[model samples]
Target chain A: MCPAMGDVDIDSRTWRLLEPAGLTWRCWDDEYIVFHPWSGMTHYLDAIAGTVFELLLDHDATVRGLAAALANQADTPATDSLNVAVRQVLRRFDEIGLAEPIP
Target chain B: MQLGAVPESALRARFRATGVRLRLAGLCINLRTDVPAVIEQILQLYGGYPLEPGAGTDDARVHLKYASPLRRFIGRRTLVFVDGEPLYRPMLLRHAYLMIDSALDWCVSANVTNLVLHAAVAERGGLAVILPAPSGSGKSTICAALVTRGWRLLSDELAVFRAADGRLQSFALPITLKNESIALIRQWAPDAYISPVFTGTIRGDMAFLRPPTDSVTRAAETAEPALIVSPTYQVGAPLALQPLGKSEAFRLLTASGMNYYTTQRFGFDTVAGLVDSCPAWRLSYGTLEQAVDAIEDLLARVRMDPTASRPAITTT
Candidate 1:
């Protein structure tokens, strides 16, 4: 049986974008709109989610690493609240097939 | 020759016998009908449109005919057909004009090779403003008002965008006015020709406003898209115009497209390119005059500096 989502430690897992090459996207004013080729769906991402998606495009990262990077970009401290928010965004991305977690 | 130039007797006979082929925005539509009311309305409204030459083939063949005697006896019904296939169940005879108008709209929507959008389009000095909105959003009313103020009507129902070139083709058909808009437009432009109102129809009291002669004469012209505006009409509300974000504008456009999914990558690329080049805004107004003034101001601004109208993009 698959492990419960709560039991899987998000910080210990790394996430990556799904089929990065096939996805078409455009960014304007820090907002991003992406079109997935396989599902033929278009998605709109706000600044935070957009930053996360752009980061994942370069390489895989854990929840902690993404939070640190986001903090550096915003010039703020990487707090636990920011980590929680990043984890939530990753969960959403996974649900929408935009990103997946490595086992 | 224009349909109006055809003698009345010949027009009726052709409509009855062999179908009158009309050239509408680069499409050949062969319309056949025996119903007198439908024919009269077509002649009154489409009189300015040119007729196809030399018995050329048609892109869409539409027939609006009276129902069989049995069906008529049951309830004075009429049937609508496209390319030898019935499009809908028999409608009431009084609703024959609505049936034919909808059939012609279907012919344009189905037959076009370009990306079709459920939007109203108008142009000034070769720059087109696309208003992408759903029905009852005051798009048609705004479009008609713009026409009265000397802006050419590209289309009041569909915005046809060529995929290869990203230019908007003119589909200048009649502007449909609903309920209160009929009187509003009539008062606004007293000289404009309007059809008799069809009361108590499915859309509830609708009429067709004949397109201006100049617009019909320039049916071959295409315009570069310069602005995208999504309008909302609210009674007793002040005029409010706000710059729309590019991502939101892209969403609104793709949502308004009739064949976005079918067009796929082309649809995505076309809409993205529009968002990249054109400035988009959300406009809400109470009165026709206010909307017209605001749009004119926007047009002037865009005409002066197209790049200045786009919302400033800053990294967050």
Candidate 2:
């Protein structure tokens, strides 16, 4: 079964992009267009989701870690709301087979 | 020699016997049809296109002929054959022109050498503007308007893009206008030549506008894409031209592509390179004049400085 955000321990899990080498993508205007060869689908990701995707491409990260990175990039504090937003993006990424949590 | 120069009797004999060979957008098409209406329409609409030598190999061979004597007598149906195989169900004989037009488009799209999109392409100052939209979205209407206004008609139906260099090859076939647009064009350009309207077909009241002689004569030229516009015609809406981001442009181009999926990675790279090199916009206008003027203005700006016209998109 696919793990939902509510069912998984968000603080203990780290997510990595699925098939990073196979996915082709280009970023423009802070938005991302990705072509997933596995699914044969082209996905458009907005700023937040695109940022999260870019991070996942580089290395694995937890929700809190991603929130901190986003906060640093935007020159803001890693608040509870930011962490919540990052978690939501991660959940969507999981749903789309873009990222999967390590067992 | 052009198709129009051939005498009626000789044309009929050649079409019935050896097929009429014509050059269209750098490809030789050998079409054989005995239907008088199809022949007459070709003589009128394709008068300026160059005729190829009959002895050489052809890229496509098409035949539009009456179905069985019983079917023709009772139903007045015709069949379209590409390479001696029936392409679709028998259509009304009145729609033979439409079937042949669509079959020619299919032949070009089926070609593996070029990536084709369902778009209207025109050129000015050696640069091309691609108008990609769905049917009834005023694509053909706007394309017809632009051609009448002095833009070279690269194509009114398909945008044939060469993947090797990302250039648009010309396919200046006749512009197929449907329903109200036929009268609209006739009223707008009184001197334009339009075929007799074939009523009660599947596309609903269709007619074709003969492409300009200059476009037909210069069919071998290719133009680099300078701008991409997705147009929409809304009744009573004011003219609006909005800058489109590259990602969105890529999405639109790929969505409109006729054989993008089959072309695979080459399609991806070529489309990406096109969006990178050219700027794109979303154009909506109630009046044709406004859209044409806005496009001309954009083209002027692009000619002046292409970098400034492109939408500012900084990679993350």
Candidate 3:
């Protein structure tokens, strides 16, 4: 079985949806995606801060749980490379007005 | 009590008749008849004022004045009347409509060989600069200042290009200055035919400054595109130019162009050619005077060396 082909539910309150232009994305809120139709550009938010995002979308986990989730993501020596990558992506999202925090 | 196709000649004849006042945002307008109701409709959107009825002329023409929305058509022709005279609104609207409609048609009818840009353009010593920015970006204010500082005002707030020859067409509209910028230019250019103040717009009480008279009659002529700069009204800051890469410039230019996507084959090429042809930059600054000086220096540099590209300057 192809592991990538299977449905990977990281958590609740976080599900993946295909955007208007058919870009696959996982988000906690609508503001994470910026749709500039004229320029034909779509930007994703909270992508860099994957550790924090993954926890929230993972079964609607809370902030404290997110820190732990990030820590766990960091602990995996084999797959932990995604931790730094996730943080960078999240920073880029913030810089471009693609990310927002839930109040 | 009149209707039907109001052509220019008929309008000329009507201007020989009863004159009325049309007003918008405190500007008085004078127009001949045969102007459409659409122009009047636009003026009404601002604040329609009226002249003292029958003050137009001896032809029994209705002399009117009113406040006008500082507007430009991506077309040919420039019309300016006294600020806040309601008696001339209809005629003024008609004049604006005729000019705008014709210019728009000229751009489209000529085999898609022209691009009508919603920007302010001017040149000095044959070197030109086109300012393309979204509304409220202080483009008009800077252009007005440059023209007064001796730059030829090719256009006050639009950049029409005859793509057939890759030459820039000129416009006769006034330099539409808003808020503090309007007063600033008035103080800067003594020869500037400043109009009365207009207040209460979504963008603040905007006033327009008349561009050089030569620009009006020379609408058919075109200039080669040189520096493409975007201006921002960030007060109390020094003027600076920032680099604009082709890709980023294309994104912003296409975003700002009025009809880039409307003309199909030509639209794409026009935008592509422009981004490829001219060097673009982000000119961010607060005060109008500082921006004016920076643009003047850039213009001087462009004219002195036709091939010289102004170094990119960006202000934080």
Candidate 4:
């Protein structure tokens, strides 16, 4: 599972400031963005990698839970396609920092 | 004037901004420019690839070149070029769109794969808020206000969401300022670095800002969905955490979005989940300082106790 980065929340195009340091985080153009000031480098979260990070953030929930939650909310029924899609997405997020294990 | 792809080398004298790459239809621009004040930003947003032209074989790939129509996006496909060039005539929409749209490939790339939003984002610790609104709204003003008052600037536009797992995608691009916003930001951040005004653009003398050095350098990062605030500039208005429901946020974000149809299912779910999970509010203010204080106050409530209040229930 990808780490959610604490109880933090994510907004589209908007950035969430992470704690303990000045690093800022957000997902832009499908890439995970982690910007640090001191060194002046922005680590862009890759697609698959970012999905993995996202999985970690929603870790408390199970795979089934995720699929169910999303399907219901988006008005789509949970199906094999969704499950496959979820796995595929999670695999990518795992590769990026978008999803990681709870630390 | 046409909406088809053109080679990059064809138009090299349009852009006044510098970014890593602008891609469309598999055509990529391996171009670069100098922004003594903003190049560090170029590097930060693009992970610090040297702007110096390389002599590698990769330079031969043809990229599209775009000029004209600065006020509104010309179309989807075209390479936009901008450099330090002088023009005798006054500028207008074409000039503005060239620079603004030039930086948009990043937006297109992120949106095609992830859900892209038209919003302003600033961070202050673990919490981040996505500020989405129409063009005339005070998003830029609020962006300048929030950044100067301690909110770490994430972006002034385009909130990207990972379609797969739903983390906030970060693009450390510089902030965009228009009209009154230029002076407002310069006044607040006197020591802050800003690009010289580019006159005759769509918005009239627009300005660009470099992301905080911190946001550009840290590449490997992610954030969960948090708050959604829609800022409306009403000078003299007060603060309100109007809890907008998920459905409302969904509609608002989708309507104000750049490419909701590009990513389909994942984009819909990602946007819906984001609106449902986080808090929402609409802030109206006459003064920049008032807006800043109101944000601090609202943020204090959210960080200290999210349950204390909810986004003002949005109706329609």
Candidate 5:
């Protein structure tokens, strides 16, 4: 099931979000460039942010799941601080309309 | 057939009645105006451009006419019309040629679907150099200098590139020089023909420099962009070429380009692809001669190794 942003009672494993509609993206080396058609805004995302959007393309995941996947992609350990940073990136994505919490 | 091939009477009559169609770069332009000065300037500067067979599909029509019949006889002002609607304020009749330039720019910027950049573009050795900047940036001055140095003039303004593939469309129009640039280019290329300077226009003093013959003859061809340089002219500052990051380049390009927001993701890909392919730079120069030399040297290195990244250079 999909999860909405800021649901305090929900566990990290149960929430998921979908990629924004009408969005197109391209990559330049390590940087990902995304075009939001509705807002007509272009966003430049670093490795982690890029990974989050790529992960949410067809599959929705929780903050914890995203952190683990990102760490696995980078061949690093998923620590507590890493989870916090991943959560922050997810919140940014929601703010920028790259992804939305499932209502 | 060149516009010069048409008789003077025929040309003037066509302007009053059927409108004269001319092929300019990738677009066909149909211009109509009864102002004698406007016709004279077109015949003088655009004599080399080919005459279009007819104004049909994909053609832009521009008309510079007096606001009223009485105004034509006495008032010293003219209005510019694009397609069927008036688009700009009336300007002094002496600046009729400038009206043509302004009208054509408006038509292209407002209608053309290409990712048009507020830039001056020139090509040499099959490589196109794009200089995108705001007004009064001396872009035209530097562009005129490069043309005198035998660079093929793509345009004095507007670098229209296809979003599908970043190929540049050339519109080899006369370069508009303001204030000191007129004297500088006249001195630099003594053989170059420059129109009489018109003073007190919106841009202060302005003159149109006739484009090179070869550039006009080859306007139909397109070039792949190789370098994107944002230039600024600073008095007494030695020529400096600084490397600009891709992200910054993308921002500047998107900001200067027209219809980027409308094209959205396709526009983003096109601009990002351009930044990724070319080594962008910011150039600041004091003198015209030094700037020309610096650009030529930089273009040589870019042609040799496009991927080579080096430190910025400040030379006197």
Candidate 6:
């Protein structure tokens, strides 16, 4: 079931995210280890965080959509906690140049 | 034909004229030196390696000679040249073999595309056991012991891992014994071929044990990783081997591997696969005997029960 998200900013709703160009990644047991060539940093990501990047790689995804994608991967319904986690992970991705939220 | 198959006269003539090219495992080295002791060391230490038959480009070109006429006679110093450029400071002329070892180390660590880790490697049953530790942690000492105990030596200084298949490539160079280890190995394995100790080298009283013939013969073989053990030698400490988690193993490998960050995501995947496929542990031991025994026991257990060491990975 999808919940109403009138309170959340539109910027977080329709924000387009994608992996940085030339980034590399590997996954083990659903956990992702990603390397950012520009920054020369290796990040360890849990299953949910990994799903977020995978979802964005195919097409631009919004926060709500990202949460839904993660839920689908895990074979569960999207929860409020999943949405909050997605938002936090996206902020981290932005800082690391892993993904950009474009207009 | 192997280097040993070539007569000393032919090797000497080759060394004096063009260079003596020796192929060891995946690397080919063309060495040019006329120094009698250096030549003797090469013929003696590298006797088991195959002679590079002018087939492909040599991976490294190293030349060792007296620094200058003045220094050659005065301090008796030698300079190491790689690709026609002097790469290291002049050291005692007697340190020519050390220069060769150092030059080869530089060549592979800087040039090879594989992810290089400063570790010792040995293989048994087609599985490589990687011992990645900082220098002076008794890595070579233990590695030499294992080789003497009939384990095939993959490498004593560098563990080169290919990213495509996550397998360890054999680099069966000599096992260097340093300082106290020099006397220790001689006493432990009297039959081992050890070079005469050269004092005043950078590492202090360094000697190299020639790699076994079997290891040199199988240098082209590659082995998938089965175990990664980080050793810390302590005096009077009881032998202890503790399980190291996968995340921690990945962290340690990234820290020690030279090209780990440069290879980016491929490097991450290579190491991740290695960690997931093998069980890692931290081993602490006081005596060489205890360490060897423990490692052999671990190998036996893993052989009997393959799944005991495999880490669990959740695909969903």
What ordering of candidates by DockQ runs from best to worst?
A: 1, 2, 5, 6, 3, 4
> Which candidate tops DockQ?
1
lDDT of 1 by residue, A1-103 (tens): 1134551477788888887998999998788888887777788888889999999998999999999999999999999899988988888888788988886
User: DockQ of all candidates, in order?
Assistant: 0.54, 0.41, 0.03, 0.02, 0.40, 0.31
Number of the predicted model whose lDDT against the real structure is largest: 1
Task: Please give the ranking of all candidate structures by TM-score, highest first, separated by commas.
Answer: 1, 2, 5, 6, 4, 3
Model 3 C-alpha lDDT versus the unseen true structure = 0.53
Candidate 2 residue-wise lDDT at A72: 93
B44-67: candidate 1 lDDT, tens digit per residue: 999999998738889999999877
Looking at model 1, residue B152 earns an lDDT score of 94
Error of 2 at B50 (Å): 2.2
**Candidate closer to the true structure by lDDT (higher is better), 1 or 5:** 1
Per-residue lDDT of A15-57 in model 2, one digit per residue for the tens? 8888799888889878998877766667889888899998888
Point out where model 4 deviates above 4 Å.
Answer: A1-103, B1-29, B32-101, B104-112, B236-241, B306-316
Per-model TM against the reference: 0.90, 0.87, 0.52, 0.55, 0.85, 0.81
* Better candidate number, 5 or 6, judged by lDDT: 5
- The 10 consecutive residues of candidate 1 chain B with the worst lDDT sum are B307-316
lDDT of 6 at B270: 81
Model 6 residue runs over 4 Å out of place are A1-17, A20-32, A36-40, A45-91, B54-57, B310-316
What is the C-alpha local distance difference test score of candidate 5?
0.81
DockQ, candidate 1, vs. native dimer: 0.54
Q: Is candidate 3 or candidate 6 better by DockQ?
A: 6
Off by over 4 Å in 5: A1-32, A37-40, A45-89, B54-58, B307-316
**Winning model by TM-score:** 1
Evaluate candidate 3 and give its CAPRI docking class based on DockQ.
Answer: incorrect
Question: lDDT (CA) for every model shown?
Answer: 0.88, 0.85, 0.53, 0.55, 0.81, 0.80
lDDT, ranked from best to worst: 1, 2, 5, 6, 4, 3
